[model samples]
Target: MQILINLDANHPTFPPGTLDTRSRSLMETYIKERFFDNLMYHEAVQKDFAVWLEAHQKNSQASPKGKRLEIRKIRSAAEKGLNTTTLLGEMERLHFDARNNVPDKQINFGLSHLIDTDFLARMAKQAGNPDIPITQRRGLMLFGATLMVGIRTSEWTTARLISDNPPVLPGETAAHPILVIQTAKTRKVDPEPRYLILEGFDRGALGMIEACIEMTASMTNGHLGQLVAGMRQAMLRVADSPEAFELIEHIDMRTARKVFTVESRRDKCSPEAVSAALGHTTTNNLRWYAQGDIHCERLTDIPLARATLNAVKKVRDPLADFNERKQLAGGKPLSGYPDLGTDNPNADLDNRGSASLANRLINPQGNR
Candidate 1:
């Protein structure tokens, strides 16, 4: 601003603090009305100034050389800063006194990079190259998915990867999927119980996890901080770019949970069932997942409604929130459980007619 002010009329800068209230007001008015009325505002301003100067001409004999400049520098600097549209604000309130402030009074922020689907697809294709090696390539997928999952950085300390698995055998027609999760976040899933049907391993998802376990087991740097440092080095070898973030940010647990939530909802599983499958303390953890951008095409085609009920029934009775154990136990509704449309519009009459309220498969006829 000071530099601009010091410049001559045809110079690079304006004269410092030389602008008075009248010129400043007119300059602001010029900026505000120029686009709407067509850019005749500068000519209009000069004409108005001539009229004003006519009245002053009789009272004073001052030269045009002494005239002070104000808004020129401030407006010029702001335009240079990419805040070109700031003048589009409420001009009635944003009046600035040029004699008091410098042109660079405000800071300018740059534009942010956008996440385009085309770019993501390109990155995914690059990730799919066979020469990249399975271990390194799988790491990128986990990292990308984890970044999308958006877990808070503070909780990374005690985060543990859980697996509910009988370690999917070499071949089996009836295998449950492997569930990977954080332990402190959920104690609902039994630590000792090993039960899950392994899902497909197209992206080397399971292999990467196995590799991580093996690496940590062999490395003497097993301490949390040391492990973090070691993983950073390993990530540099794989990512090879300045964009690779911290190793923990690449873990896929959160993404896997998001996948489950999307699939559960796409298949229209009840909140209770998703809660059990996710090992959540309540249905609240799903709130974040529900808000995510999950494509319907990516949803697993499992009958979540039925599978959910089966899973829910296996949970121990007399849970913290679940009562009416007798009704649900005998496949009947107690006082608490909603029985069909009699009380709640979304109640299950079919389930009530069947065996246990807790064991009910989705009552399709009911308002789910």
Candidate 2:
């Protein structure tokens, strides 16, 4: 007589003891939805999945980074004993082959390359004029705000202006007007929303932003996306002019940030201060924006060589006292030329005639 051994039913690989009703239900449901008849969980499968993920290209359609994140989620679910084998198998089968070495798309625009303040002022003035279309005016207002803040287009669009507790008195200046940026790119490192202080020439930037918000409040339905887009278009039109075309070939959000970074350095702001203001965790990232040819037109006026020479003279005596030596050492002229003046009488006569003719031509009445 042969005894029937129920090896499948009493599998040692399964977790021991009865799971709670919810856990059991979840596990059963996951297994039923995902697993096939022949599939089974194995340590080797997990290893293979990890190796495949590492070898895969990171720039594929699903993005390797994104896929890795999803894998992490599956791993977490599996650790909870909810469809462990099935989820691991699915993750292993996923295609993660994408290019990982794609170069960064950041384009650094130095201060020299960006449009000057005169062009910006012209655009702002035209935008402020009542004769222009309201839509164009609104766009110019936003553009002025962008130029002033040097923020990303998305940030510019989403940013809100909150006045100080006590409104700035008329005919008086506000030291720092606040610009609240809702969505920042570096939220992972710096989670808090940025409240930027606007000072100097940028103080009016917030006013322009507020004015734009007010003007388009009805048309935008409280969404600044359309307003932002219109502003970008308007800026492009302004850039298209012959005078500004060379300086501002295109209006790029990244370029705006780059210009801001360079200008901040030019204004003597420390790297730490600039990085903090720009919502960056490290000054290393600021290098990309700050590493550009400095506008040294004013530096040329410094007389560095002359100043260095003067400094050296103060430290040491002259190599030779040429002034004193000049009295001691006299040199004789060359003996070959006896007379330096014009010797030919006919040549002198010719020169006098030419001179008299030139004088007569100048004063015809005197000539008579």
Candidate 3:
């Protein structure tokens, strides 16, 4: 799939002595037209599925088993593609490829859709209001939590508050709340569940989540999923005013997540810390969203930095002795603890043996 997207018709291959300018021209024209057609089809398919899903949802109760099956099939099929998996790397790389001068705007990563923390605080306050409709309350909570904790929309179906036995950090006397959620896109590998610790300002986030779960308790899983997914648009109807409404006009779940990612890094949080907060097993996603170090200070004088520099400088090129060592180890890399030998200054044991061993060798007073 990526190969098709990256095809370069300008460099066409041909057999020896085969001079065919017509074939070369034909290939170039075909590739140009093919990309255009694919782009159009992608756009059309998205619009078609959205319309179909809306219609199906309106007639959900009245829709027959066949219609329901079709709706599910269409939704699944629309989401299945290389684009989803390659979003963080391969697709992003295509934009920087010199061969294709793709404009930065053409690659929509949603990194610029930053939501104001003040606005999020306002939504959080609204989420606690009991006078509003339950749906509206849940919608606000959904939006707030996504921005606060970086919860993916799909994970909402399985998200729940697990405040029991909150782990207390060092020097902290009281335990804080925790939001337990299954990491999305990782159920296949049975990945460990992620627990988001809610402390200080974020302590109320768990309460709002609890409220959302309590109100939707009786709802079926399918209905719950639908309601949670709709919160992206439903949130606007619950907005406080024209300003709040306008703020979220172009925002979706992904955009909310992007705001969280960008804001976290902007606030000087470490990339590894942000990745952990986002429930990612690695910093790969963090790199894609934030890209590069947020803090640019070069601290080469620090102890660790000096130690690392010294260690790196001491490294000998393995290729220099490759030929001599290759046959000695049957072309396999040798593995063992290098510091255990006598050459190590830190090792307690030496070639002569330990002081205790020397003491025993003296046989206490004299040789018995």
Candidate 4:
């Protein structure tokens, strides 16, 4: 409301503080008039939707996830003689900001390139291509497994694949395959391992995880980081476009973990269930990772509605220019100006550019 009032030309100017009662009243009246006008509001909707979408994108891009990822990279760099003090200070500030500030929570950030089914499928296809390097194929397998199970970067070495109980039990349809992951970032409070049921994924997804486990059987956790890096390069080789390449370039464990949580929530799983899958002992931390369905739907659908409405041109105010011209002429009528106020009601759309492009194109003669 305050933003709307500040944007209005006739709004009263005041110091940088709370709005006065008159300003608030004017803002309310403006909103009511805009809502009740009932005549097509395409122009206003387009303008407002553009502003809102830009702001949403900006906030999502500036999310704490980016900062945390950067902090981790810098800390890792410091091990090889990047300034340790500065890195530690930055980490501390990140923690402080997270606690004190309201970070931008993204909505409907599901099924993106970072964790899309098609992207995974393409990588899997590349894995099976004998022409591709065996090392690249191995990395792709590990990449798909990490994304599907949402394993932490550090947990790659500790993650173990355990088959369902009585692996070959006849007609055990309820039996679910398990992936055990040693929890990271527990700060020594909750270091217990978490189990993920692989029943949610299909046989193809299981193949990726199985292949990854077989390849890494002889390697230690310390070697897994380099393998993950190789996966990023493999992803680049398969990316079909520059935008896909950019998103794949920033692929990290956090992105995969977020995808897991969101996809789980999309399946109508309770918050507690999703939190447990994420290895969180409580649901308190879920807010940073995922939002409720209503918020996501509202934001994701706004642009869709805006695109459909944008085909029609803006509605012109016929009296606006005439009134301005009259005011300039000392509130007297111009000599040659025809009074548009007296024009026929049916002809109102004539000079107003109110006819939709589809209608105009279909009936060039303007009969219907």
Which candidate comes out best when scored by lDDT? Answer: 4
* TM-score for each candidate, following the candidate numbering: 0.35, 0.40, 0.41, 0.49
Task: Tell me the spans in candidate 3 whose CA falls farther than 4 Å from its real position.
Answer: 1-114, 121-134, 168-175, 201-203, 215-247, 291-368
Question: Can you tell me which runs of candidate 2 are displaced by over 4 Å?
Answer: 1-111, 129-133, 166-175, 187-190, 201-205, 212-249, 291-368
Q: Please estimate how well model 4 matches the true structure, expressed as its whole-model Cα lDDT.
A: 0.51
The candidate, 1 or 4, that scores higher on TM-score is 4
Q: Write the per-residue lDDT of candidate 4 for residues 1-368, one digit (tens) a residue.
A: 22232223445456556897888899889968876333212334333433453355446756666655554554445334423433333333343334434343322232242455566667777778898666666666666566567666566666777664524223234556767677787777756566566665566666667666667767766566667676677778888887677667666556556665565555445445555666665556766665322112121100000000111112222233454345444464322223333323333334545443232333221111
Error (Å) of candidate 1 at residue 17 is: 38
Which runs in model 4 stand beyond 4 Å of their true positions? 1-114, 164-174, 187-192, 200-202, 291-368
Residue-wise C-alpha lDDT for candidate 1, range 174-244, written one tens digit per residue: 44444333334445565632222334433344444444444434333234344343323334444433443
User: Tens digit of lDDT per residue, candidate 2, span 1-368?
Assistant: 33343423546544667567788889888867775222324444444445455456343567556766766665556546534654443443332112122222222332334445665656666776777566666655655555456556556546667665634423335534556675467547646555555544343544566775555445544445555555555565556456455434444445545656556555545454555556564444655565332322221110000011111112211111221122223422121111223223233333444223222222211101
RMSD each, Å: 19.5, 31.0, 20.1, 24.6
Which wins on lDDT, candidate 3 or candidate 4? Answer: 4
Q: Candidate 1: which stretches are off by over 4 Å?
A: 1-141, 144-173, 176-182, 186-190, 202-205, 215-256, 267-273, 293-310, 314-368
Give the winner by TM-score. 4
lDDT of 3 by residue, 220-315 (tens): 666655545556455565566675566556555655565566566555454445656666544455544543222222211111100111122222
| lDDT comparison, 1 vs 4, better candidate | 4
Which residue pairs does candidate 3 place in steric collision? none
lDDT of each: 0.38, 0.46, 0.47, 0.51
